[model samples]
Target: MSDQLNTRQARRQAQKKKQNSNNKGKSKKQLIKKIAIATAIAIAVAIIATGITVFAIISNAPELDEEQLMLTQGALMYDQNDEFVSQLESSERRMNVSISDVPSVVQDAFIAVEDIRFRDHFGIDIRRLFGAVAANITDGFGAEGASTITQQLVKNLFLENDKLMSRKIQEQYLAIKLEQQYSKDQILEMYLNQIYLGSGVYGIELASQRYFNKTVEELSLADAALLAGIPRRPSFYDPTVNPEAAESRRNLVLSLMVQHGKITEEEAAEAEAISIEEQLDVTEREAYAYEAFYNLVLNELEEIDGITSSDIYNSGLKVYTTLDTDAQEHVETVLQTSEYIQNYPDNEDFQAAITLLDTETGQIKAVGSGREDSGQQRGFNYATEAKRQIGSTAKPLLDYGPAIEYLQWSTGHMITDEPHSYSDGTEINNFDGTFQGRMSMRRALAASRNVPAVKALQEVGTDRAKEFGEQLGMSIDTMHESYGLGAIPLSTKDLAGAYAAFGNNGTYTQPYSVRKVEFPDGRVLEFEPESQMAMSDYTAYMVTDMLKTAVTDGTGGTANISGLPMAGKTGTTNFDRDTREQYNIPANAAPDIWFAGYTTKYTAAVWTGFNQHSENNYFPSQDSSRQIAQQIFKAVVEEVSSTIETPDFTMPNSVVRVGVERSTGYYQVILRQVVRLFMNYLYVVMSRLEYQKNLSTLNLLAI
Candidate 1:
């Protein structure tokens, strides 16, 4: 009875233990089920969030202008004779070729260097992208580029060169779209065509021609490898300038080709041993030799409506300038063949500038800013930018013109040429030390008498003279009394325009360089000069008549062009204070000289001086600044006279010729001559008496 009772108890205890074990198993399974459900919900939420982000990025993408993708063409410049001058460089050199046309080695070499997985990826390579991100985080800067060829093409064509995250994302998106639109071969072709190689060379075709003097199909394995290396850093790897670096880069490309199974080990080794110098055939590119003229054309083209300077330099439009090729060539020849240029001073301080303008239309016919061969480190445009004192050239613009217009002074009107003091307490004297007392306006101006010019300015009032000068395009806005003596600074170009007004019947026309710009699509933008009446025809005629007298028989006699009816003025500034300060000199001497002259056909101005304002200590024998001007003027005028008949200056009805005796009208003229004659006779008699006394004294000594 006791055994049975014990057995029953043990069985009950076992059953209870079994039931507890089963309950624990069920609890473990339920816990695992809850955890799995929570994890699945979290994963679903994450996927939904990722989809939302991608959708937002795609929906808010910025719109791109398709026209911007079109390749930029360079502008062509032509002379007036329709001769090709130069091409204004704009975009890259490019020649599109199909994948079949490209050598297999060429395609393989570029693929190995630029992008190894170019064929397998769909625009963006996720594995390479993640790897690049990790490397960029670990390194100081991001040196690894995971961009595929498709990505690069899209970034170059459709996006700016910004390295921000947003730009990268846009680039990726556009690259994916481009990949869908175009085949892999097509993208590769575009990439090869659009990339910049070096030395202003763009595209593989141009690079092949420039470096190897061969086409893409003619390239060897070594040649292909070398060209593939240049697009990475053109300047640093340029075969001509840096052959060692270029060779190193080429060897690296060959090694990459070997690693990528594109080229065998033996082939890579052989190509690596090849010299880039042997393959290089760099030649000087054809360019325009006229620097100032090219610069002027570029400057003028910048002001057009649809064209910018970029268009002139890169868009490949044709620019037809107002430059007459014959005139330009003649002017350049005259300046280069001049005795002054042949024997130019060794000192950098000395420089010369000349500008010629057409009277019929204010076209800049020819410009010589500096020596054509001067390899000057500092670019000083003496014709347009450098301003120097014009001296007596101001006589016509500031003194005589204003005097005739406002004070009703005629060419023969009497004006005293004695020393004069202005209201500002400034005193001025004539060019020569001794003045002729009094002289007619024509003689004063022709002789370039400083005192007379100052007095004339006073008669017309300095304020009025300033206005009159400004109207004629002279930049004389100073209130100083010395302005009548050409103390104001002006450029040769500005002076040329101001002088052209006199020949153009008092009409001030703005000078222009480019006559017209034609677009690649045959659209034309023409340039018309702006003109305004600057002075009365009568006043201009009077001033011109006085200037003609100057060239004929006055201070400007050096500039007389025989058989050419011309009028001009000569200006010389004696010892500039600025020059003295610059050189720390004790005395002042004339440093700046100018000759401004005009005919009915053209007006020209020549400036000669030291760029550094050197002291006037040294003087050359054969080439004084004035003599140089005379040579230049004669040469250019003779060339122009060959083409056109020399026309006479038209006289206006308001100007009438009135003759006057040389020594009769003014108070000092007759009286000074008579007194001078009597004094001369008395001196002769006294000298004869003194001689007799000396002779008598000698005879007494001998006795």
Candidate 2:
């Protein structure tokens, strides 16, 4: 009985041990499940944190305000009245042109060449991205840009100038947001206006106008296609300098358009049949075109707020300025086309410019920078930039005008025309250096006699000349000090304003380009020289009177207006005059001759020459400057004199008297006070005939 009981207990013990081993295996499996659940939770938390950071970055990208956007676009110049001038930058073809108003063909042409699926993609095209990546990896950078219209807009509006991955990231994020906020059409319009095509073209309309001289509406299928080809490589396909290459490129664009179904193969063939123009194949950009007035407004705008150049274009501020539109156009047309019959084709060297201003309001009416394709931005704006040696032109304000206004010097006041050494050792006279035995200020000025002017300056003192110029708004104390005899540099613009004091009855109206600057919202920030005055009324009248005698009988005789009371001066810079003679060639070249004159209707300044020197050995010297400048001035004046009524130039009292006697600083006569007034009719009216003095004393006094 005892042995049976022990076997039963042992079997039961074995069963219990097997049960414990199974439980251990199950517990281990349960532990592994808990660990996996914890791992997945940790990964989920990390992913959420990462997404939030990325979202924050996407939410806070840099962007441009309306004004800033427009500035980046670069379109701000306007007429005095705030009318549109030219669009400098931007892509929407946004030129105050509405999307619906634009021709469908233009729209299609751009879409075809740029991003085909632009209409469907929500700012980003995965397909294009992949293609761009493939191209970047296989080909080279810039070979393909995956920037959709919206992406490009974002890049232009929000991104910096650097092309980097950081900028690309920002662009992608902003592009998606832009697509959500703006319509495809709005984005497309902005894109067209903002992309830079070439030749300073900014918008589709301007691009059309520049490349075809035709309106966007007027652009043919072929023309539209050719223009579309420009955006990819503007400098490369520039039709102006490279034609055959541009043609090939344009044909490729056509092929792309056909492949993309934007145009039919038949249409592409027709476009291919179209001939490509080798030069300014579109329309020519007119030179100057009121550049002076435009610059004036620009400067003032820079100081003000709201009315930026881009705002001016899109906002269309009513810039009611002082410019006389007709006068501006007249001056510009005359200078550009009808004035000079010749020009230096493309100056491989040198540059030139011109500007004309309004005498009454100091408004710039016209300006020129030669040919549009000169690849120069009015570099050496002769009107304001060039510090050239102005010959007789400077003498008027420095020597003659000051003498009469400040020194009690009369136009009839006589001075010897014979050459003499100055304290500095410089000797000057007329161009020929021929001493007129005896003459009046009238004769001397009419002939541009240098010795008489130098003597007059000597009598007036160089300091006095400096003082006079400073009074007239010339920023030249140093120049004034060196005003000995055309030693100081002067610009056409400054000189014109100085002479204008006479036209304006002595009030020097400071010349300005911009009329007024208005914020984009139509609030004006600056109106240049609202109270600008360059000289006093008395001084202005005095100077104008002297200039009258100059144009009427002086060296500016070539500038006389038949039925008008006109006054002006001739400026011949010291360049190569005649290489054959010793000191024969003057200081500047001849092509820089000038005729700054004014009538009741228009005050114009003319400068002529091949703006650039040719590589073919033709140096555009002073001779070219004189013959062209004077003739152009004459032609322009003659045209106006025939049609426009002449206005009255304020007549100042007294006149320029010459030949009194420089030998003794007095007239050669019985009484020391008896001045042998050459051209004695000047003022023929100052009744103060003077005091008792011996002839010896008077001759000594006059000289």
Most accurate candidate by lDDT: 1
Q: What's the C-alpha lDDT at position 659 in model 2?
A: 32
lDDT per residue as tens, model 2, 1-703: 8898998998888888888888988998899989989989988988998777667766667754555444444445666566665443344333545677677777887787778899999989999999988998888665678988788666655554344555666788888877877889888877776665655455677777777777777778777777778766554565754567778878887888888777889988988987685323455554334554554444344334333233433334445455556655665565555344364334433333455566677776665434343444332244554556566677777887667655655445667777676667855546664778666665666677778877777777777777777767777746442364455666667766766666776666677765554443345545566534444444455556667777776667766767778777776654443442433432432434556777655566655434433223233443343455555566656664676566675443322222344333344323313443443312311102211222234433322
Clashes of each: 10, 80
In the range 43-141, model 1's lDDT, one tens digit per residue, is 999899977876776666654334433365556778766688766454434565567788989999999988888899999988889888888788733
Name model 2 segments beyond 4 Å from true.
Answer: 1-89, 92-325, 338-354, 371-387, 480-484, 526-539, 576-591, 610-625, 638-644, 652-703
Q: In angstroms, give how far residue 251 of model 2 lies from its true place.
A: 40
